[model samples]
Target: MFVLSSPSGTGKTTIARRLLAEDADIALSVSVTTRPMRPGEVEGRDYFFTDRAKFEAMVEAGEFLEWAEVFGNLYGTPKSYIKAGLKEGRDFLFDVDWQGTQQLHQRMETDVVRVFLLPPSIAELDRRLRGRGTDSAEVIAGRMARAQAEISHWDSYDYVAINDDMEQCFTRVKTILAAERLRRARQTGLVDFTRELMR
Candidate 1:
């Protein structure tokens, strides 16, 4: 599993979307949430929307690989079919917050690769949020207030991509993913290949 985390305006989601489109080997881990579905979002593809009661029941049943409450909404990675996919050599990409990343790493330390994205500057972050024109000023201020705390965990991630330039950052993340796939532990089938060659 690979994770990309960043403050709200840092463009991590965009990077993850492009990465998923370009890479055939990796699939995004769609999360389940209690938040209302937005206009363009499709069920299961974007998020598995559920009522608060059902979301809470899932937590009680321990159905989540990782879960967290963010800005009053509960979001979780369901432990659905991921184990079988992993055994078949599939990669999963997670676009999550730092809290979610922490929970995931705690549960799957060896299987996890964590990456954090940094906005170039506070001013730039503010600019990006304002430029989106999607959120109200109050909401933007709330996100800005929380950004610093979220970014404080940067040291915990294995890699950090500075979002100074979109293309450069995407290249760096893709390169990281490539290198991670080649790691000795992840290439378990290589043992059999090597032994066969020796025979």
Candidate 2:
């Protein structure tokens, strides 16, 4: 499990999309959400949309690896989906906030690689949010306030990339992924290969 987390306007989603497009080994983890699906989102591809009751029921049954309530909506990662993928030696990418990242790390510390993206500056983040023009002034203000709070948790992540330049930031993130993949503990076949070489 690889996690990319940042404030709303910090380009985490943009970088995640590019990484998924370029890397064949990693697939995005589609979360289950109680939020209504927006346009252009597929049911299983983007999220597993469900009603509040069903989502609560899932929680009661302990179906989630990590779950949280964000902006009045419930979101969770299904353990069954990720467990099967991990056993097959597949990588999963997670695009979540600090809360979700913390939960994921607690539940799967050995398998989780946490990366936090930072904006060049608060001013730049505000400009980026305003540039989108999809939110009202009030909402933008709220996001800016939340961004400050989120950035405070930067030290908790395994890696931190500052998004001063999009291409450079993406490159840094890719480098981190590559290094993590080469970690000795993650090399499941290394012992067998080394034994064979000695023989």
Candidate 3:
């Protein structure tokens, strides 16, 4: 599991999109959310939309690998979907928050590569949030408050990248992914190949 986490408006989504487009080996893990689907978001592509009741039921059934309530909506990773993908030797990219990252790391420590993105400055973050023009002043205030809280947990991540420039930040993120992919434990056929060579 490769996770990219950041406060809202820090461009984590943009970096994630670029990484997904460029890396065929890594696939985005579509999470299930109780939040209403926004405009331009596809049902299964963006998220598996559900009601609070159904989301609670899924939690009760132990269907989620990790779940959390964020901004009054419940979001979770479906355990089975990720497990099946892992079994097929596929990597999953997770766009999650600090809480979700913590849970994933606790459960799958060796498999999880956690990366956190930081905004260059609070002023820039505010500008980017307002630039979106999707939220009201009150909503943006709430997000700003939450952003500070989220950035406090920056030390928890395996890698931290300050997104001063989108392209540069994306390059750093891709580099982390490339290096993590080459970790010794993740190299599947190494032992067998070495044994055959010795024989």
Candidate 4:
């Protein structure tokens, strides 16, 4: 489980997009959400959109690996989907908030690799949010408030990246992934490979 978390305006989402586009080895874990889909977001690609009631039903059925209510919307990672992918030796990139990442790490600490992304500064975060020209002032205020709260959880992550420049930030993230992939326990066939080499 590779988690990338940041405040809304930080380059986390954009960096995540670039990772998915460039790295064939890493696949995005499409989460299920009750939030209304954005303008260009696809039904299944961006999120598996559903209603509150249905989402609640999924929760009741214990379908999620981690779930959280964010700004009145619900988001969850389906447990079965991710487990199957892991069994097949696949890597999944999770673009989730701090809360969801915490829940996942608590449940499977050994499997989780948490990365926290930060903006250059609060002022820059605010500016980037405004640059979108999408949200109203009131909405932006709420977002900025939420961003501060999210930043407070930054220390909880295993790796922290300050996203001042997009490409540089992505390179650092990719390096982290490469290092994690070589970890002894994460390399599933390493034991056999080592034993064969010794023989």
Candidate 5:
């Protein structure tokens, strides 16, 4: 399992997509949320959209691996989907926050590779947020404030990548994934295969 967490505009989703495109075994873990569908977001594809009451009910039922309220909406990863991915030996990519990462580590018998991405600088972050042209200046200011809080949790992650150069950052993330996949715990099947080859 891989937990890829970052502030709103740090390109975590882009890295996740690139990873899936490169690895045949990796599967992006689609999360369920109570947030309104953004334009072009499709049901059951981008996210499983639901109402706040229903989302709270899932929480009470212990159905989610982790849940967090963000920007007046709730987002969570369903526990069942993760279990199914593990059964299939699939690498699941979680584009969640640090809170979700902690929950997953406690509840699952999974090897989690956590990578937290940081913007090149506060100035660059501001530029990128404004570049979206979707949010007003007031909203952009709020996001910058929130981003500081988010990045403060950098120490909680296993690896940190500064996305100054997109291509370089992508390469670093890919390298991290390749190295993590070779961990002894993740390569149980490979151990036997290698032993047979040695014989």
Candidate 6:
């Protein structure tokens, strides 16, 4: 139920991993995509990489909760996995874009918590992208251009964290998680538990 979204080079994945490492209750939802694997990626860990045909078939089968085609690849979240996590009373993390967040909010409004991560500046975004050194100059330019469009949707999110300092950003996200987990709706059952104790 924790949907963490950020643009391509904002270090969302790194923050997610650190959060997962620190909290055993949080689990990351692996997205399935038609994009090819990067050098260090594993089959199911990074993404469930598949061909365009398979991705289209899954779409036809009504398997994805949300899907979007970006630049030339398709990315989607599997519906079954998210439901399973919620049923088991586990917190699931999503490293997704705003479009996916929209679909998720429509499907599970009360149970979802969304956070947006922003870079300190466009210059910093370029620096981070270049630091990765994975893509060509042309691809980085494409990502930078797309980032503006992506960031324009920040208002749709519940919380926004500027990634100026990693530790501060992590602390802010953690604070939001703690507060959201105690929201009145989420803690509805707590009243009954306490009443039973009093009785």
Stronger candidate by lDDT (2 vs 3): 2
| Candidate 4 lDDT tens digits, 61-96 | 989989988779999998888899999999999988
138 in model 3: Cα distance from truth in Å? 5.1
Once superposed on the true structure, which residue ranges of model 6 sit more than 4 Å away at CA? 34-44, 48-54, 132-140
lDDT per residue (tens digit) for residues 1-199 in model 6: 8989888788888899899999898888888999989999998788899999999999999899889998899999888977987787788888778899999899888888999999999889888777668889898888788888889899999999998988999999899998988787777588899999999
- List per-prediction Cα lDDT, in the order shown: 0.91, 0.93, 0.92, 0.91, 0.86, 0.88
Q: What TM-score would candidate 6 get against the native?
A: 0.82
Instruction: Give residue 64's lDDT in candidate 5 (0 to 100).
Output: 93
In the range 14-109, model 1's lDDT, one tens digit per residue, is 999899999999999988999999999999888999989999998999888899987799989988656767888999999888888898999889
Off by over 4 Å in 4: 35-44, 49-51, 132-139
Q: Please give the clash total of every predicted structure, in order.
A: 0, 0, 0, 0, 0, 0
For residues 1-199, could you state the per-residue lDDT of candidate 2 as single tens digits?
A: 9999998788898999999999999999989999999999999999999999999999999899899998899999999999999999999999988888898988898999999999998789989878668889998888788888989899999999999999999999999999999999999999999999999
Give candidate 5's total backbone clashes: 0
Worst ten in a row by lDDT for model 6: 180-189
TM-scores of all candidate predictions against the true structure: 0.89, 0.92, 0.88, 0.88, 0.84, 0.82
Candidate 3's TM-score: 0.88
* Stretches of model 3 off by over 4 angstroms after superposition: 35-43, 132-140
Instruction: List the lowest-lDDT window of 10 residues for candidate 5.
Output: 104-113
Model 2, which residues run further than 4 Å from truth? 132-138
**Clashing residue pairs in candidate 3 (N, C-alpha, C atoms within 3 angstroms):** none
Model 2's alpha-carbon lDDT is: 0.93
Point out the worst 10-residue segment of candidate 4 by lDDT: 126-135
Q: Give the Cα RMSD of candidate 4.
A: 2.5
Candidate 3 shows a clash count of 0
